[model samples]
Target: MKRVLNLVLQSAKPRTVGSLIFSRNKQKMAVSPSLNSLSKVPKSSSPKPQIFNLLTTTPKTHFKFTPIFKQSTLSLFTAGHANQKPTIKHHSNSSTRCLFTGIVEEMGEVKQLGVADHGGFDLKIHANTVLDGVKLGDSIAVNGACMTVTDFDKRLNEFTIGLSPETLRTTALVELEPGWKVNLERALRSVDRVGGHFMQGHVDGTGEIVGMEMEGDGLWVKIKTEKSLLQFIVPKGSIAIDGTSLTVLNVFDDESCFNIMLVGYTQKHVVLPLKKVGQKVNLEVDVLGKYVERLLGAYKTS
Candidate 1:
């Protein structure tokens, strides 16, 4: 029996012995050169050790390496590339756009025949449209200010309207020269779809039309309004200057005036800066102001 055992052990190769021992009880078997040779073993200097350490021992939070066996692919079914730019669609008329007719083109002449203590003045405006298809008490925008057509001359194409000294102080029409341009839009009616707004034809206050000049291919007009109206005016905020929707720009707290910046496009197409210095532009605080005020009032009470 002893002789037979010795022969059997001697016949077995070192690699074969290691394999047999490992297959029987791998946990108890130590890795050795005999076992290494049997399995076409990897080279000792292989990059696998470093790669294993990077994936296992190093904190997952510190290193972001992904394993080849665990890798996944992402498929996109969308038509365009992820980084492609999107196309933009242009509309015909933006809300900021204002349209006016030809009748009251130039600034009308203001003749203050009389004045009252309550800031009132008897004024005369010689305008073609004011006299055309217009009757007494009809609303007309004079220099961007809304005024009732108190009287008109069909033959001469001229008209007359009354303005309080308050109106004079609040609008650019106060300093109107006979040939200056004035913007005109009729008052909205219930049958009308309220194209602009419910204009009272009453000027709340007047703002100073200042800093008028050519900017690029268009004219740039700036106006200064009282600080009381500043809170209601936001950048690109809507404000009615002489019944025209003008945008608000550059609002300041300490200053009494809020600056209204107008682009050249508005100047060329709209009657924004046609008046001179010390000219009063009838200003109507945005209708949104009343709603905002109501909301704030409700909150305070609540």
Candidate 2:
């Protein structure tokens, strides 16, 4: 009975010790917080862990996030960089028929006259027209040919414009001198009313002023043209002789020169009657020459 009592006491002591170890382990686990429980804890109670997570995770979310407004803004910036502005062209506003004004500075004196080697003469004009109202740089149309005022004479209405050798052979002005009368008109201005045909003040060549005869109070003047202008010359066709508009009286096939029969009114109002035989007159072929040239040029290109 004594041996049985000692063995039972030893076994009961081991059982009590095991039960105490198990109860202590369970109490520690209950006191400790899990991941979900930590999230529910007050921020003030766990500031250190909360701050660490915010610093690390905030940067990752910012890097990964993309807003719709930011994508649209980026697309607009890229389009602007790739696009280019369009270019515009400007044109000039001036007509081809623009005529410049020319003030006569002097009444040139004729030095010598006759046919020239190139079919015109060297006309020597000594006049004061250059010194009175004209400058050395002024432009003048001598018999409708644009020429620079080269010399001046202040005492006398005199200026000099070189007549080409071809002009002497064709026009009666080749025989003009100090006492001869010259018909003069200023250049047409933009504001000035256009009274006659467009005059370029460019004389193609000269023509002979054949005759000035009075018939029944009217004057009839005749001019001889070169073979080149014959086709363009027609009766009643518009012609500018010495910058004055004149009509063709009769265009004869037999003769190279055509006649301009002027009425008595034109003979009195204008300088038609002043014209005499053997006198040279400046001639402009026609304005239609430009239109014909343009049409032919376009046809060739096509």
Candidate 3:
């Protein structure tokens, strides 16, 4: 019995060495020879051990490594990594993106609103200061909504913008009528000072004016919005209403409503004061709050 066990142990030694090599690089390995032939591996002058590179494999599985020095970026691509061609998506009417500071530059009047030839609505607004140095494809925030300038007339001080179905569904701009006033702001420039909190000119949703009253020289305004949006609106937080940056005074979570104050100076500058109860206004919650919530959600899931 002792002699039979020794023969079995000697036969299993070679297979163990072959498996060690396969586990190190995860490559197809062949059966190795016994300990008597172990010195057959070639010696190298370099002190470092040899490392395997996958690029030397078959053409279809080969990958390329490119190092960019400008920004210290490394990119890797392989033939088998992607089976389909990459595609880029573009909006039908707009081609550029812009950001705002939630500061109303002027009050633009709605001159015309009609359907566009290529689906969606075409809006024409009459404005003064926002048109300065404006180009045909420049972005303009109308009522806290970003819109591309499809056409502009310097002499008439009017510009045309195309609105998609998504924009109409999310914003109060759908309720606009001729002669109605809307807050307008040109995209912020690198040199311009940030007078208000950062805004993307993307309206989260529309809120209806539920209550209003005068508090000495300042006016108190209450707006009722969707309950889901209340999580982002907190007392003493920043909010954008119709492109006007205002600080929230109170948040009635139970009622799904919030209140903000408009000083005498602000009342004269923005069109929010002109809006009466039951009127719909574009609302943008603080972007930071949304980002925090998204990050927390990722942690919870993980």
Candidate 4:
């Protein structure tokens, strides 16, 4: 028993310590070339064993270190496309329309109005707050009608808009003359809080201011429009007059007239009350009503 114990203790002693053994079908066990190099590294030079080369002893089996980034990264360091001008794409349909909240930003003065060299009418308006960040081809509502900014002058605080033939035939913008004040509002952005109802700045028609009277600190104004437009005007519905949003108080279908009460704040901000009776004002009814009418018409036709 003592002799057997001594033999077992001798066998337990390690013949090879901290050595990795690799096998191919268990026929022969061999140390990998990279592992052999790691074992050969001086302990004094490196606290731990280090691999000098990633290649293995077996030529058939090659181990290579892949790059952290690929060739696609080369474009990031190149400047070939730096000077290229960016292209702007525009839609040809109604989707191209810009939306507004019917909240007038400021009143702009008609500085100059004349025929443009391009055949349309060019309107130069002197404005202040509305010109901030306004660029060429941007849309601005003039008298509740959406017009594109054809040119601008930051120094003069003025901008020019082109009025097309269709605009002249549809709405009352043609009535604007030099020194006249027009309601101005910028296109709504996604981050902006919607203060009033949605307005497309597309004037459906013009309405005549038939009556105006003072009630308390508010102003009671009545406008008479055509039957075609009066059908869309409803009590408590939203209506934009000259780019200022107002709630409809009463709609007299028999008289083809509707009234709205503008608070003191609204009265001072808008150009509606400043105008006298018999003057035509651009009118845009609630878009929802127009959409409903179209949907019902489709069902009726079917």
Candidate 5:
């Protein structure tokens, strides 16, 4: 049970100093250096002690020392001492890594060719350009929903997401048929410009497409949902339709119906336009509204 320790001494022509020693009898002892060993050190007349370092082979183990110094003193421990091991703790202020803002960049279709035994649909996403920096195990926002990557094919520039039973129940993806167009967006990166509002890829509710009207070069899509999800919608506020971030142009039907504005560029890139007016679409709202509500409740309680 021996522990290694290093010692540094700054001394001039001065009285002999002692080295730290631990007795097996559970006592601390200070043993001075032998005269023969002290005589080997160079004699100095300076008022301050010259810096010297030593690694001694003491027979005793488990020792700690604090060397005195003219300027400052510090105590250090070698790895040989094993009293406790460091532990990692979870902090509330730490980043919640799974957050995503709905900003669709690509489109793909669910193919029955490579469907897995787990009953998950395969998405043939072409991610070569926008997702060039994407790595395995990263989450992707699919149709305003979050899905984890299960496999990747670098040659084909494709990835697979295995859907659990829980996902099929809550999301509009369950209605996806073969060759159905799907909106795709990678998880928000830290260096991203954040062109859209804060989103978590959480499909709080599903909405049914009521109608689509052409407005100039863009298109306006009307959506109807339950009242439970309607309270979060606001005019000119943010909303993600089929994973594409857009603003709510208007809210009607006691807040159950909302309108989304899709510019010509967005209409060309996203898959939402491919679907008909009677189909259902995944819907997600900005998470900031929920946070504000939570803080307001806390204040009311206080």
Candidate 6:
């Protein structure tokens, strides 16, 4: 019994002992190679090699090491792909469109054709929508609302977006008479740089422009919203008002309202400066907060 106990202790001390034995299909067990054999292994030179091969023990079997490489400052980023530009893939269908980043540039022209008898408005389009891969029949966001391009002229940089009766009823766009300004953006592409939080041109609801005053080099806009909408808003969180993505500066008065400071650059660029108090604009709360709420709800119930 004492001799058996000695063997068990020796087997447990792998570093000091020579062999560890167990029965799988008890046969001749190949003892593990000693640390001396690894020390004798030649250094590897393959760039970003995941496994270290000391020596080819056989034609098929190699002594692979998945352990950390003992090297000084190994770079994970390689110099080879630094200059390679990513090629943007184009899709002919609008449904599979990439919801990348929203566009702020002044591009695309929208002209009204005669109002349809069915109660929608037809529009003629032509303008330089700087976004690449904008094929005809693709979707574009006009003034923060998604619109489908009915026709286009590539050379002239023109396309058309039609507004249905439902769109006019739900949006402040109904106020758009002849000769009004709007911001236009093509549907997001996969390669477009994400400069802001994700926004879908769906227009979750609308908020009124309550106040606009000069604070710094920009204008401070205070918007009044439903208490329900404000629940999803947080100070420094992203919210899209009037289709323009802006960060909330603060939530005021029990979260019934919020303020966003627009820099001079944004104020000058967007049609937001043209908006007036008591006028309503589209509002889309950040999608991230809702997803987080759902995930937290799952844990709470569990």
The estimated TM-scores of all candidates read 0.52, 0.51, 0.69, 0.69, 0.64, 0.61
Which runs in model 6 stand beyond 4 Å of their true positions? 1-92, 95-97, 107-110, 117-119, 123-126, 130-133, 153-158, 253-255, 295-302
Q: For candidate 2, lDDT tens digit of each residue in 150-218?
A: 455556555555566555555556557655555454445578766566666666667777777777876
Which stretch of 10 consecutive residues in model 1 shows the poorest summed lDDT? Answer: 94-103
**Model 2: residues >4 Å from true position, as ranges?**
1-133, 153-155, 164-172, 268-272, 293-302
Model 1, 1-302: lDDT tens digits are 55664576577743355334322233553433343356555443543534446545655486566766563444243345556777688754321233332222344444334553445565565555445567677766665556666567777666767775667665556565545555655544345455344444455677776667665664555667776666666776666776566566666666556666556555554455655666667777665686888899999999
lDDT of residue 143 for candidate 5? 86
| CA RMSD (A), model 6 | 19.0
Which whole-number lDDT from 0 to 100 does residue 212 have in model 6?
91
The residue-level lDDT of candidate 4 at 168 comes to: 88
What tens digits encode model 4's per-residue C-alpha lDDT throughout 144-232? 89998889999999999988888888888888889999999998998998999899988899999999999899899999999999999
Report, for every candidate in turn, its global Cα lDDT versus the true structure: 0.57, 0.57, 0.84, 0.84, 0.70, 0.68
Worst 10 residues of 2 by lDDT: 17-26
Residue pairs of candidate 6 with colliding backbone atoms? 125-159, 126-158, 126-159, 127-157, 127-158
Each prediction's RMSD over C-alphas, in Å, is 18.4, 15.6, 16.2, 14.2, 18.3, 19.0
Taking the tens digit of each residue's C-alpha lDDT, what string does model 3 give over 1-302?
55664575566652444323211223542443344445556432444875665455333436755433334323255444467677688764332356788888889899999897777689999999999998888889998998899899999999999988999999999999999898999888889989899888888998999999998999999999998788999999999999898999999988999999999988988999998999999998998999999999999999
Tens-digit lDDT track for model 5 on 201-263? 778878999889898988989999987678788898988888878889899966479898788
- For model 3, the superposed segments whose C-alpha errors exceed 4 Å read 1-96, 117-119
Candidate 4 — which pairs collide?
A: none
Model 4 scores worst on lDDT over the 10 consecutive residues at 14-23
TM-score of 5: 0.64
Locate the minimum summed-lDDT window of 10 residues in model 5.
4-13
